[model samples]
Target: MSDRWRTLRRRIITPDVSETRLDVRGFHVKNQVARDILETVGKSFLAGYAIAAEAKDQSIAERRIDALQPRFRGFAYEGAAMAYAVIDGLSLWRRDNSPRFLAGPGDRHIYMAYVGIGWAMARVPRFRWQRLVLPDPTLRWLALDGYGFHQAYFKTARYVYDQYRDPSFTWHGGGPQSYVQRAIDQGIGRAMWFVYGTDAVRVADAIDGFDPERHQDLYSGAGLAATYAGGADEAELQTFWQRAGEHRPFVAQASAFAAEARIRAGLLVPHTEVATRVFCGMTATAAATLAETTRPDGPDGDQLPAYEIWRQQVAREFVAIGRN
Candidate 1:
């Protein structure tokens, strides 16, 4: 296809930017801060997607994304990762670009990049799913997390209100599919933070409304969202922690994860710092270090996926800290 045709094809396939608007999506707006946070995320994501769709090379896209402010840069990377994954999945002609990007410029934004792949998975048909690049065995689960976030954010009523779970979800027909649902629920839990307008109590209440078996993962997702996106103040974070109750360890684990993501990208913002303090009772660096220290040596071990083991270990650290 001609370059113009490719551009047109992408345009036809990509969702409209207007779909991200609060009014268009019918998402709640707790206040200006909440509105700004969600809108910025949408805008950055689209911006990255556009760059990836149009740029002649990965370096060009990386340079453009680098121009974005630190606070939103990772979100743009997420969008770029999504676009590349979509390109790879839909166009057999394209090289395996997503993996290259992930191995290079997208490395710092690895978490967001995996989530981006999940977004691409959501857009592409199931038959083409195998074509998309998901390099990390452990972190690859974040793609499902992204998939969950995309569904909950876009189809809130069915996902959030009705508490839906896809019984047919399978990870390329490997492993127990129930684990896939758990990863997705984590993403849904993350989206709840944004859907409720970053109101800590509302986010907590939404998690509470879910099945008890799902609460720990939900709290993990919400905690990651709250700490990473940071729409709440210290007092609000304290409220969220208090409400988490039995799930406090999970939430703290999320804080550690969020801290590591931000710190790894050199995009640690003040809001993240405040959130880490409230959620983990430590600096963001310390929380990130804790996450690293607790991570399993490999991606799979001891019969359980290494990813879950890593998260469980982090949560145990929090429990050991007397927060249990």
Candidate 2:
């Protein structure tokens, strides 16, 4: 499977070595593996949820997720993390049966997972300051693109009420969950960076309308997006970095993580040279060197030393730079 992924990645990434084409024919092939990655992680989440549900303890689910992290690999590892958010959210929901945990964007699994994070945050006594706020664009896209799934899940299946249905229940009846919403919205912003490529102005504008309080979230999303799908000139990215303000280091680190994740996923190639240079302040060659250094080639159930080295180098560079 790894070899096959390499082959597919080479076919798409090497052919153009310029524009990252999303509309090209056979693009679905690229996503087939991504979909598989999502599925595998989803199954794991369900299994974890079952354990937590049976034990009547959410910590059981958290422990299951912690145990599975080293097992997660490849480019779509972050996607798996997203799935775990759902399990975590559901675990909390099963424990307390709170309405907040019950709310989500219907059955859009990704959106549900995002909402799950919000749900978890709401119930967790630790992060009480965090609010549940879904950004406009996140809602827009999920409603538009995922309407069918939403309708099937919310209307027909009634997933929100599956475990416990209240006769007078309404989605958002008790108000909204903001923290995870911002996080997910930030991820959407990052996706936009890739979708729009180097069009920094457009990406910035899209998230600009968001409330100023959420700029940090937007910047975090923008940083990861720029790192992975960036094509903007340095000045444009610098402007973005400045907007992130004190959070610039955070954004930069996320960018480094994005770069490494892309490399591990087998999606990185010379074509993304511009992104590496702009976001990481490193030549594509240098960035690729780190990618090769960090490639997870260890035996299953084993930790790889290269992974730590890559992480340390990324952290050191970003910390030294401090901003941008």
Candidate 3:
């Protein structure tokens, strides 16, 4: 099944030998994989952000995190840590649920988001502060252009470490969880860099290596080894896993949500060459999920209009990408 999906994706994404590239302008939209990724991840991220926002009183946010502690147990962290975890969680959830080949636009959005976040963290102070405050920005400007998006996943990881520092943000006597987080972050960052900075073949390689299924455990283990391998035995690995367990579920759930969202958004269409496919994929997914799952009285309901507004903006962006 996985192989079939891969072949399909390749056929959809890659042009024939006679052609230079797939004319992504108007391909078919056979499956719903992309929509699924967007919807699911968008919902989870929004939920986390809302919780974080309402807890703006710091003490309030801490309490909310505490109240949600059982569900997010091993995943506790401060400030940006929490934000990034939410994003990672969404990615994992999508992967766990869907066919691997149909990442499409939702995957693009994640890459874009990471690039934008990295750029904001690396360049803009207001953007960084805004991210720390709100996490997910409604404004479509959050998606950076190609040049700005060139930075790899690991580059962003390094930036995260450089920008934010907590002397106490370590694991259970092992070392700083940030260290492990940094590696995973960097790995993903590098993967994105390959995707945007280079060619599709490189992107494929990075995706293969850093894929959630194959690399998640390896990345986790590498982090543990880095933080606790000094003088410890097998106990260290077990302890590391115990501490990180809380985050595992969050990651899985969030990834699933992301996949679902993409499908609903229509941005995950088969061969559409519309540049905004990525943005539409994300916003559409978020909007659809919010409409279905969020109560009329909930924040999701309130954000529906906002999502629509953003969708239009994304459409414009797609036109712009196509023009260029």
Candidate 4:
């Protein structure tokens, strides 16, 4: 195994006994604070993986998650990401027979995972940009923000340079000209979204300084972030959906994806399905079927690949369906 992987394995499997130095390749991660956060993430992963692995059923797993809180205490956002890694690991180890508690949106942990990913990215040390491939599920997700951070940092830097170079200078605006640019912007917005606790109003409040006309990509980025993190209720989602204005369809599509994630997470019980249905037009049945089919025993037999395919299709559907 790669040294990084071995290090993580040792840390997660036997944390108390393992006091080895953290060595992520290409990353100058010497900061104690950053290392502690990373270690917390690892511990969080182990907690989820072990619980899911041992549970008799979904109910048991759900009940077991409560005990993991103290282990992940103090760092809510990072802990959530770590928990997700555990779920992902559980999904991988069990393959076809993944537990239901770790399954869908009906479970509360799914939303926590998305939030955790956002928090991790926001706190990523600039030095670790090159080693975005650190051997951890949560870090892999966090690495996605590098694209956005590159654009945000440079664009803002240029903006700062211009303002300082010439007091009378006006801001020059640009839109994303390529997929990478769009991804970068989206990543940035997602990070901000997490930092703001996925609250649409809070995110809106935070990005109010951004000009929608000039920073179109960031606007879209914020929309995607809010939609996915879904820190708000259905009524709030509707309000935020309308708040997106020009980016409404994109935001709606993101909400649809969140709904899909929730469904896959197994949160689509009969009484609770309406909330997501209203939020994204994705019904419980569709979500549940997709969740089932993506499982190892399901027709497709692989959750990760199946989920991406479903997300794309659902996104297209939401866009075509329009915000109405």
Candidate 5:
């Protein structure tokens, strides 16, 4: 079935281009290179969103998304997934279309697609949340990561400056709900990388400003963003690796996660390889393999979800290996 009022919905959903600009967001601007990295991600996200919001079918959107270069292509998929989630969540006028995208072209970018669902959560109201397609219990927390990233990126002053936690956040699994904030903090940490303009010192300082308990998760998020988005050079990545200190294992774990995301999406680039080397002491391929092999098989656990268990496994392995 064709999506109704596709044009009108597209106009309503897509954000303004200027809004993602550093100056518009009043975020740090380390240099032109950093500025480009941040802006390119924004542009790529918008492009992907538009592809989904306006395209007639999933196949059309896939073709357009595949045309993008490796580094930015995954971001576009992320944006497209966000659009699909939004469409499915808000478009009660029709049947769910998100599954089509998620099961097909989006399968490879599943990590990003979940994050994209989180982006939809940020835009879609709580009442409509039930309609969203979040079948995978283990990876569902990633939607919060996307929501956290969205809030921290857009509401920088409230989230980043004040370090505000939304006591009202309602999403929780059958197990302990305490991990909710930790998952969100990871997204906030990811946003901080862009907020700090990819400056290793500034990013580390921002992480330090957070509550001590949140440092590890924050480092994990920032590590993923740094590796995936890739504005920093080899030295900068090494600097970030050193700055992680005791949290290096989480950073290493997250770097591996990023590697797997890129590799699965067929978007792995040299910068990702370099970042993986610095953090995981291995190539992106090896790091991704570790992430895959270590991933726990089964449903959500009684205490910790499978996602957290997987992350812990990878982190422990890095700690044991002596990250450099």
Candidate 6:
């Protein structure tokens, strides 16, 4: 095994008994902080998505724009770009005694940037259908294409750069990109397995050499083996899989971009296709189902809301992809 992986394995499998609880506590605190940051960002993203979706409705008359246009006009593109920049900057900040609860200033900046982008997109007078094209569909594809790439770039760059910022850090388990990709892939499999007869105990045991019970504190509520012990009914699993298939196009595109970025960064084998078809299929199914159920009026209903639909869709896909 690579030294980095060895180190991580040792840390998990044979932790120093005296320091075990302390380490667990540290991890929990950091994780909670991270979760909070993600939640805030997610909410902001959902709001932006909803506004944009409303603007995209074909049925809405031009006069209606007077009321809704101002809702997102100020931030649209600028807000999103700023959010990306902020995230990039925050990830690079270094300070001693920084509270784990708050992300670095860069985090706040990134949030602002995203807000700006959303506002701009939401406020555009004509709904700019050209901006929605993807995968080289049109001359405007470049702008749309950059959106995901920018997000991934900021996330991966921040993570990798953070590790490197610490002189003692070593890159391991393939590399950050590969590691993340594998986790995403395996997470999907594990989640599916969990739906079958796998339990938290089994998952914990499956690791190189860790005591399941001792590590129980590391898990979120869903991580509890007891939660999955009952196993999902076959019919439910089948239904989920069916829905996942519909989202294949979007998932495939995202995975392809991620894989390409990893390869270009030399973080993984140049030829590796880190994107998994199976996982994409599963996640797509879940996303489509969530979109349908959560926004029955399509992306136009005020009652259900557009951004909420997008958020639910993303959440379902994330769940279908499993925990990473």
Question: TM-scores for all candidates?
Answer: 0.95, 0.37, 0.24, 0.43, 0.96, 0.19
Per-residue lDDT over 215-297 for candidate 4, one digit per residue giving the tens place of the 0 to 100 score: 34444455544443333456765665555566554554444444454454443333234434654466655534543343332
- Model 5 TM-score? 0.96
lDDT per residue as tens, model 1, 220-267: 899999988878988999999999999899899988999999999999
At residue 101, candidate 3 shows an lDDT of 10
Q: Give candidates' CA RMSD values in order.
A: 1.6, 16.1, 22.3, 12.7, 1.5, 21.6
Give the higher-TM-score candidate: 1 or 3: 1
**Model 2: lDDT to the true structure:** 0.40
Instruction: For residues 204-302, write the lDDT of model 2, one tens digit per residue.
Output: 665565566655555666676566544455677767665566656556555655555455444464424555565567765565464445434432122
Where is model 3 poorest over a 10-residue stretch in terms of lDDT? 96-105
- In candidate 5 the C-alpha lDDT for residue 273 amounts to 93
Q: What is the lDDT of candidate 3?
A: 0.29
Candidate 3 TM-score to native: 0.24
In candidate 3, what are the lDDT values of residues 56-155, reduced to their tens digit? 2334434554443221211121121233323323332332111111132123233333323333233333322332212333322222221122233223
Where is the poorest 10-residue window by lDDT in model 6?
A: 132-141
lDDT of 5 by residue, 1-324 (tens): 346677777788899888879999999999999899889999999889988998888899999999987789898999999999888778757647777888898999999999998998899989888778777777788888999999999999999999999988887334458788988999999999999999999999988988899999999999999999989998998889888898999999999999999998888899999999899999999999999999888876777777898899999998888873
TM-score of candidate 2 against the unseen true structure: 0.37
How high is the CA lDDT of each candidate model?
A: 0.87, 0.40, 0.29, 0.41, 0.89, 0.27
Candidate number achieving the greatest lDDT relative to the actual structure:
5
Off by over 4 Å in 5: 1-4, 172-175
